[model samples]
Target: MDTGRKQNLKEARTLQIWNVIYDIIEVVVSLIAGFTANSSALIGWGLDSTIEVISAGTLGWRLHGEIKGLDERRVERRKMITLYVIAISFALICVFISYDSISKLISKETASWSTVGIVILIISLAVNPILIYYKRKYGHKLDSPALLADAKDTFICLYQTVVVLIGLLLVKWLGWWWADPVAALLIVPYAAKEGWEAFSKAQRIKNNIDRK
Candidate 1:
């Protein structure tokens, strides 16, 4: 490999590693505050964070393969397996979140406004768009589909952050507690879409392998 490509891979690996660490912290904080506040938005954000970890991990593994000169077929197979697991997991998360949000709406339960969630969303807003910018830049430069896909995932996270922020602000500022579950329900279709995309990608990979 040329020095430029090698450097690019190194940078991509570093970025993925940092993504993993950041997601872990977000997962813990979001989940804790979510349950404590009974906020479906925060809980859905936490679940999405978990899926981000998997996406980053898959990209990291692909970068590792690139660096180690691993067999292309073998790496693709591993990638398919990872994506399948993620698709299944995300589908389950979507179902759970949908059920919780619908139940909360039906019962007319009000989630207590969480200052912590507000603070976290603010931080996420500041951080994630910047992450998306770099991920897209490097992903295109490196010709990495996995990194590009992860950039889209980061974009989704940013969108979720904004939605949750609006929901929390409405609850705290305007006494619109129902906004919480409604905002969380917005996450469901996006989650299902992503899950379907992943599943389709996995199937395509399997078909390609079979053809080979």
Candidate 2:
């Protein structure tokens, strides 16, 4: 590989590593805050962070393969596997979030005001855009579809942050108990759509590989 390409892979690996670490922190904090506040949206967001960790890890593995000078077929196979993993993770998250949110709504569960939940979500809101920008930048630099797809997942996280923040604020200030579960429900369609897209892309990669 050229020096420029190698540098891009190294940088991408660093970013993915950072992503995994940050997501681990977010998962713990968000889950704690979610349970403490009885907020389904926050809980779903935390679970989403867990999936983000998996997605980043998978992408990191593919990046490692490239950096290690894996053969072209092996690298492409790894990329396809990464996409399939991401798609499956998204599908799982969508199902989980839907069931959890719907159960909460059916049970008439009201989320209590949580300062910690609000604080963590606010921080996520501020941080995700920066992550998204760099992921897209390096994804383009490397011409990696898997990396670009991961960037889309980050964008979804940003959207979830906004939705959950609004729901938390509404619950705290306006006594809108339904807003929390509703926000979580709103996340499901987007997750399903992205999952399908990832799956389709992976299939296309597989078909091309088979042809070759």
Candidate 3:
């Protein structure tokens, strides 16, 4: 491989590794705050972070294979497996979030405001935009669509956090108990969409490879 290609792979690997670490911390903190505050949005957010971790890891694996000069077919086969797994995971997230949000609604469970949740939201809002900027920069530099797609996913996570923050504030200030579940419910359609996209992309890749 050329020097430029090597550097790009290294940078891409570093970015994905960073995402894995960040999402690990995110999953722990979000889940803790979610259960403590009885916030369905937070729980759904954490679940989404878990999917982010898997997605990032898959990208990292693909990049590593490239760096090792693996056959393109081999690398693509692995990616296909990863994409299928991601598709299933997203589907599971949709079902999980839908069930929880609906149950909360039926039970009339009010989300309690959490100082910790608010604090985490503030931190994520401050940090994620910077991460998104770098991810997009390196993604373009490397000309890697997978990296670009991952960047998009990061942006979505950032958006989800913003919605959750707004919903929590509404619940606390306006006594809107349904706001939490409603915000969480919003995530379902997006998750389902992502699942379908991933599956379709995987199918396309598989068909192309099979024709070869």
Q: Write down the TM-score of every candidate.
A: 0.97, 0.94, 0.96
Off by over 4 Å in 3: none
TM-score, cand. 2: 0.94
What would the per-residue lDDT of candidate 3 be over residues 132-184, giving only the tens digit for each residue?
88889888988878878878888888889999999999999999999999999
Candidate 1 worst ten-residue window by lDDT: 113-122
Each candidate structure's count of clashing pairs: 0, 0, 0
- Which stretches of candidate 2 lie above 4 Å from their native place? none
Q: What value of lDDT does candidate 1 attain over all alpha carbons?
A: 0.88
Ranking by lDDT: 2, 3, 1
Model 1 residue 65 distance off true place after TM-score fit, in angstroms: 1.5
- Give the per-residue Cα lDDT of candidate 3 at 25: 88
Q: Model 2, 89-131: lDDT tens per residue?
A: 8899898889989998899999988888888888888888888
Return whichever of 1 and 3 wins on lDDT.
3
Mind sharing the TM-score for model 3? 0.96
